[model samples]
Target chain A: MPVTNRQIRLARRPVGPVRQEDWTLTEEPVTGPADGWFLGRTRYLSLDPAMRGWLDDRPSYLPPVGLGEVMRAGSILEVVESAHPDFRVGEFVSGSFGVQEYALSDGRGTRRIDPAAAPLPTHLGALGTPGMTAYFGLLEVGALNEGETVAVSGAAGAVGSLVGQIAKLKGCRVIGIAGGPAKCAWLTEELGFDAAVDYQTEDVRKALRTHAPDGIDVYFDNVGGTVLDAALTRLAVHARVVICGAISQYNNEHTVQGPANYLSLLVRRARMQGFVVFDYVTRYPEAAREIAGWIADGRLSTREHLVKGGVDAFPETFQMLFRGANTGKLILDLT
Target chain B: MPVTNRQIRLARRPVGPVRQEDWTLTEEPVTGPADGWFLGRTRYLSLDPAMRGWLDDRPSYLPPVGLGEVMRAGSILEVVESAHPDFRVGEFVSGSFGVQEYALSDGRGTRRIDPAAAPLPTHLGALGTPGMTAYFGLLEVGALNEGETVAVSGAAGAVGSLVGQIAKLKGCRVIGIAGGPAKCAWLTEELGFDAAVDYQTEDVRKALRTHAPDGIDVYFDNVGGTVLDAALTRLAVHARVVICGAISQYNNEHTVQGPANYLSLLVRRARMQGFVVFDYVTRYPEAAREIAGWIADGRLSTREHLVKGGVDAFPETFQMLFRGANTGKLILDLT
Candidate 1:
């Protein structure tokens, strides 16, 4: 008997916050792998804030997911069957496998990951795109220096959590801004962040002044809007503002609220730059090796909020990011 | 008989646009220069848009003009008497003389200017702060390359006119955005700007698309607001946005309007930076010599709207900058 493959596809472009009706879950019969092709059974799907940008039909760094097409996603999968020379059966691999139970690939962007080295979901979090985004966004784009004060928004999220740790490892003072006391405590106590601001209960600008008294030298902005505005006000002279992501404004039905205090860049003689992590793909191996070393020494910690559900759970699982409900990397475990 | 110094003093901080009540015209008997001081009779007072910023009680690159104090201004003056060793009587000089008929200086931050080298008004227009702003802003901050496309707002103003002309000299395609058909025509026909967008009549974003089809490589922003938003959208990959001034937002009683499409920086892998001309004070002579060479060879042209009025006319003359009534440098000639 042929296997049944369950998949989630985009039904329509989302107006604001993604609704369940915007996606359709369907199942199809799977066939055996053809020549030069390998069949993979999806194990975990990476749910990212950036994924929200992919659903819109606007021109961006990457093309938007087409209506009625399988929702684009990054996933770690087990190669159950293969006719390809490189990929063998029963080996775990990571690639853009979409929101599906089974996928066929010729191994273009696919990379083999050792489950012994790190957990399968870890490949979708700290060792994956989130890791890459945090690494390059802080070290390269933010141009962080030792002894400098670094501030990162979305402090409890995957990218922001890693950013604070990396900045700390580089001998810098780190301040993390998150939604609540629990998430903020997790950053300062568990992740070893120098300070954490509970943006929900505290005034961000006042908190930043108290925490980073000398002003922030590097601000890795993951959440743009009023947080970005508060960060702008506290910039040290010649500070660098790295535009990693703007998760705060991603699902806006109207226009994105810009940083009204951006003129602070002028008064401070600073710079605000933006970049895509894929632009540094060729250097990913170099960064990954360094990050893995830190993790091995127990200096760097990794966390993931794993939701045990099939591909059909993508919509609800994905909404956790915007709601700030997840502590770290949010992943759907489809095992 | 002692000279009576006519002066304009700040009466109160302005809320929105500057009103007549914000200033007080007064006269005081000027005393002879003391040891290490020089006395100067103000000739031409520079009316700049940046002056608006100094009137507000906010922390900026420069301190706000204090109430009951002489209005801070840049001016051309004739040294009438000198007790300082370096400055001599009967010579012309330029310095911060304020909006007054006579000023006393300690010779610090003062530069002697030969009337034969350039006209007295030209010293304030192109060889002064405005010229320094355009040179460093376009070449250093903007990091302009040959054959690249450059777009400048306030294209007919003191700094914008020079930026467009300099880019043209560097083998780049230049587009100027200014209000009114006359200013737009002057930019293209006289200043050699490749194209001109009449922002008053045309949609700035649509006009930029038509003029800069390949997108702008360097956007020298002088007038921020919607114009900055328009320029932000039309930036090329790796474009540089030099934030020199935001004249449009200077008079706002409320908050400034930020570039709503600022995320384009990420999509295009671009950067937006701000700088103060005073930061490059040491290199001013080197840039001045190069710009003077361009002027001598007819490659650069300087224009000044000379208003022949005494120091009392300063309040009305300064308002012309906000109204966009001046074609080039607006100078109140008190000679």
Candidate 2:
């Protein structure tokens, strides 16, 4: 175990987009695990769009990260010392271990992860929160069916990429909307998405018409803005819109521009629903096992944009999430 | 049969709140029904919030009313002359007969109504489109469960009133939000709604906090806008918000301000779904039977704001719906 621990703490709440000055890195002497507790060092830190919402002091699925506290994040941790009966030394586990070198846990919400199953960072990426989010948000909340057209915004990002892949696995036509040509090409070429619309280049509304000629049956929305509004107008009867995340609106200091075409829900007799992956805790093992099978069978692709640095890299890396700077899962390697 | 048929036709689409000048009254010579068609005289017309949406030249569940075309409406009609096999003289039927003294139907989308079962206006009110909207909207779209809390906006209006009543009958605690003290009182005292919030007089958010301490499980929203936003904030985990109508935004020539607190769907893992009652046509008889049973058992009450006038009064009476000047179902009786 390290003699000292480095931690990133929230210094202030962000306005509009997050900045480096909002976080503070500090060092403290490491302490041994107490009774019913385990000490683990964070290996891979997971950065997500939802992290922005957690920075604001508001009521969400999870509580906001308080100022002067270790910035909250999901990470892969290796148990260094253990006083808890269920956790032991050298075991890899994942949980909300925060953006720090070491985490002290009573094993309340941590789940053991196997390095042999996939890479350590893969657990923070495809096999971790992003993977689980894609799994449940598409299958459970979206209720996707075979041969249906599934369109997703932020198509090259962590949740959106995996959502398209899984929808394809379920025998559905997948269309992705991304910011640039390179990301759009990556989605259609490498990830096997049926088609990709580069929002930065093409008119999304017109592209959606050309691609999804039969209208979208299920839309996995990760970025909410005008893209969502365009998709709204093209919904088939009984379309199920999974409100996974709205990265576009997360950084907005102003009010969220809710889809002006929301009445399309009435016109098309459709549903738009939101969910938190944590709500499916009991079913996680089942989903994780299936997703693992897909990965092992080479049906699912896992990618991580790894940033090599200590705790200080968190703020800059987190900014990449909202700016659409990083594709696939963005991670910070603390080791 | 009348020698001449008086009708109201759309003059031009209104930019905002409909004006009297937007409609033109005309008279046409009454003709005998052609082969396979029946002639009918209108009795009561069902004035609905959806009428405003139909007036606008936009794509919706149904097509918009075209300029110079007889204004489309649902009404109770007495078969004055019959050339169709199934039609008999004086039989009452309901269909899209438009705002005219006489209609010609081929029995395609028409359903016969028995005046002996309830008053003729009741069929246009508690047993017609409004009642059906409340039934499927609450029971199916909202997926309301016994003992859950249901909050509805436009509490004194046709659909909202019936939604609260049906929710209460299904063993749920019901809270209503409406304009004016009398309308709120009608919901709580007359309709058996557990609580009522007068949106015009009280702080709706604060009232919702006090009434639905556990949070609203099913919110049947008819009048959207700020009230919908307030309800969005007070949702419980897995709450269902049925988006039946947004009368508040129907007249806006500008953009619709969607719920600012819609992210609460993500926070509480809730759902917001919109539906058209026409989509539930296969099960209308099933719903109508149950709702009529409630009325027979004295568990339901019926109210109609009756307006007596010729076709020229159509424009002014239609305005009553948007102005909230009429309680319950607003019907123009042409008898």
Candidate 3:
């Protein structure tokens, strides 16, 4: 129980953009497990934009990461030693293991992840929280119907890409909205979305009009400022808007711009609902089975944008999500 | 055949409040019918707050009554002569008939109403558009489940009363929001609502918190603006808010007070859906049958605030609704 561990801790709460000074790298000897505890070694870390929200001292789905604590993160780890009979030493597990090289777990809310069925990173992406998010957000909250039209903003990202593809799999005509030509190309040509509207150059409202001539039935909103406004104007009757994450407004120096044309909901008889994926923890297995089936049948695809550097690289790896630096699922390999 | 006919026409558009000057009384002679036309006499003229929306030059569920034309009104009339095969003499027909003593109909969209089941005013209120609206708004749009709590604004009015009673019949705990103590008393004492909040004197938010301690599951919003904001704060998880009417904001000289606490939908993962009851015209009969069954079993109570007046009293009868003058269904008996 004298294993040395290195960790990235929150030096200060970030203002605007996260800086290097916002983090403190420190080392400590990993402590031994108590009666109910199990020891684990970090194998991979899940870099998510929601981590940014967790840093701010405001009300959110989860509490903010305290200063001088190991930065909160979802991680893949191998149980190296165990006093808890349920967790074996060779088993792969996932939980809020934080940005650390090694950790001791009491197995409060840990789940075993199978490395043989899919890659370890898939547990963080297509088979994990982000994947379950896209699944529940689109299908349940969005009330997505087969053959309906779906439009997704930030379409090339981890959740958005899967959202578009899931809509397509549901027999919906899917339109992807992303920043650049590469992302748009990947959304439509590679991911099999019905259309991709490059929001960088094109007028999103006009593009929506062209792609969904009838109107958008489901809008999976990731980038929320003006893009959310644009989608508000094009909602069809009984449309369901999934307010997943507002990435565009996250870095705002001012207050977030809510939609000016919300009256459209009154006219269209539509609905907008927000969802945090963790709320569906009990239903995750149900969604995972459906998603895994799609992945296995060649109806779905999984992509991981991996960045290697272990726990020390947490700061820069976390920044990449906000800058749109990584595509598909952004995972940090501890190896 | 020729007969003297009297009609109320839209003479001018109202600036703030509608007056007698806005309408013109005219007497005309009903001539012989064409091949498809039949003689009809106006038995009951519907005096509704929505008449105000119909007077304005804007698009709504129904088009505006054009200047110099007969003011549009839903009427229960008796077919005195038959030209169309589906039509027969002495049969009461409900249609978008103008405010007139007598007229000829081509019978495009008319429904036969039996006076034996209930009176003509009951047909216009409890078994007509208002009843149909309450049924579909609660059952279809609200997706109201049994044991869920339903809070309705303008709870003493036609649609709101029906909404509360229907929710009760569906095993929902119903709370009514009305303007006065009398209406609130009637809602609770007679209409079978669990509680009624008098918004005229009491703090609505505090009242909602007291009555619905667990939070509101369905908000059938007949009165928008401040009432809606109050209800928004009390929404439970997955709550469905039905945007029926905004009578409180209908006559406002300025813009309606759009809810600022709408982000509660995001916070609770609830939904707000707006629908005009006209959208469910196809299922009006289905709504009528269920509502009638509830009435027959004494599970639902029907109340009409009938203003005894002829066609000359149309403007005043209409004005009463905006002032919240009448409880239950406000109708004009043009007998």
Candidate 4:
């Protein structure tokens, strides 16, 4: 362990697209764990679209990261020292440990993760928050069933990629809407999606008509804005729209453009619900067990784009998420 | 019966606020009932906000009325002749009998309505589509519970007035938002709402803060422009928004302005749903019985604005709904 811990802190609330100036990379002396607490070194950091929401000074599922505080994030950390009874040295754990070299947890939200069960980075992808979000958002919030026609926006990204695979595993006719032909190819060819809409080259509304000839039964919406509006226009009766994240509107300098065609909900007797993964914390183990089984059975696949960098790489790596630069799970390898 | 039946037909689809030119009143020779059909004398016509959506040549739960077709509407009628086995002469029936003096029904959507149970016009208000919309939209879609804080937009209008009352009846704290002082007064004083917000006089956000300090648990949205956006901002965690209608955007010459702060759904883990009352047709009797009982016990009160004129009055009376000119259920008394 180093004598000093490098940390990224929020300098100010971002108005629109995040800039390097919005964050301050600072170094502090590493401290020992207090009673009932444990210290861990962050090995890998999960870069998520939801991180953008936390940068805004607004009321959300979680409070905004306070100015000058360590930027809130989720990561896989290896416990180095512990004064707590439950935690031991060399055990890997996952929690909202923020962007820093050293993380201190009193075991409040921390859970021990195993490297042998799956790769350590996989815990941050399919077996982690992204996986759980896809699980509950589709099966619980979305009420998706077998043979239902599902359309997923941002289908090449972390949560969306997992969502499509899981929906496919559940026997759904999956149509993925993603930018670029390469990402679209991966969704249909590799992920077993029934069809793929290349939102970059094709008209999404017309493509949806061609692909999902029957109206969409479940729409896992990750990208809101025009894509969401187009999906709204093609909902089947009693459609369930899972509002997981709105990556498309997260960096807007102006007001978030809402779906103008939302009245279609009335026409179709449909519902749109938003959910946070933390609410299903108690059931995470159950979902992970099932998802791991699928992975072992060769029915599910997750890809991670690991960028080798120090703490300063956080800003640029996060920007890749909005620009569609990363194909799958975008992670910062801090080690 | 009359030798000539006076009828109002659609001339053209209105681009904005409906004009008289969009309608053409015509006279047709009266004809006797055909086999499996009934001839009825139209008594009361229910004018609704949904009438505007029907004017648009778009796909909805029901098909749009073709140009030159008699304006489609729901009304109470006295069956004068019946070749159908189910419907008998002198029976009061409720169905989608168009805007005409006499109507011929194949007894498809028609149901016998008892005058002894409730007054005839009440059938079009509390026991009608508006009441079913309020009941199911609040309880089922909004998932409202006792002691929950409910904020209803257009609270003095047909569906909204009933929504506020039903929420109160179910032991909720109800806050109503309406355009004028008179309607606001009726919401609080006469309708037994805990509080009222006059959208015309005060800032809606401030009023919502004052009335629903804990935040609105359920928002029964009727008017869907800025009012819907305001309600979206003030929702409590896990709040439910029932989208019954959007009278505010019905006459817009442009696109319907969706709730700009809809991302609040994700922030609060909330839900917004839209439903048409006709979907609950099979359960109508069960809901009507309960609502009627509440009316008899003085737990529910309804006010009707009756306009007496020929079928030519249909266009102006329909416009009154959009103008918020009527306090409660707006009806056309063609008798």
State the fnat of model 2.
0.74
Q: Evaluated with TM-score, which candidate comes out highest?
A: 1
lDDT of 3 by residue, B1-335 (tens): 66788888999888777888989998888875678888888888777766776787764556788998988888888888878788888999888888888877898778889888788888888998889888998899999999999999989999999999989888999999998889998998888899999999999999999999999999998877778888988989889988777777666655555665565676678888877777888988888887788777877888888777778888778888889998878877767
Count of clashes, each model:
0, 0, 0, 0
> So what's the TM-score on candidate 2?
0.97
**Model 1, residue pairs in steric clash:** none
- Over A176-214, each residue of candidate 2 has an lDDT whose tens digit, in order, gives 999998899999999999999999889888999999999
Q: Which digits, one per residue and each the tens of the lDDT, describe model 4 over residues A135-226?
A: 99999999988999999999999999999999988989999999998999999889999999988888999989988888999999999999
Local accuracy of candidate 1 as per-residue lDDT tens digits, A1-335: 38899999999999999999999999999988899999999999999999999999988899999999999999998999999999999999999999999999999998899887688898888899999999999999999899999999998999999999999999999999999889988998899999999888899999999999989999999999999999999999999999988999999999988888888888999999999999999998888888888988999999999999988889999999999999999999998
Native interface contact recovery, all models = 0.73, 0.74, 0.35, 0.81
Greater lDDT among 3 and 4 belongs to 4
* Model 1: lDDT to the true structure: 0.93
Residue B115 displacement (Å), model 2: 1.2
Docking class of 1: high
- Chain A TM-score for each of the predictions: 0.99, 0.98, 0.97, 0.98
TM-score of each: 0.99, 0.97, 0.83, 0.97
Order candidates by lDDT, high to low.
1, 4, 2, 3
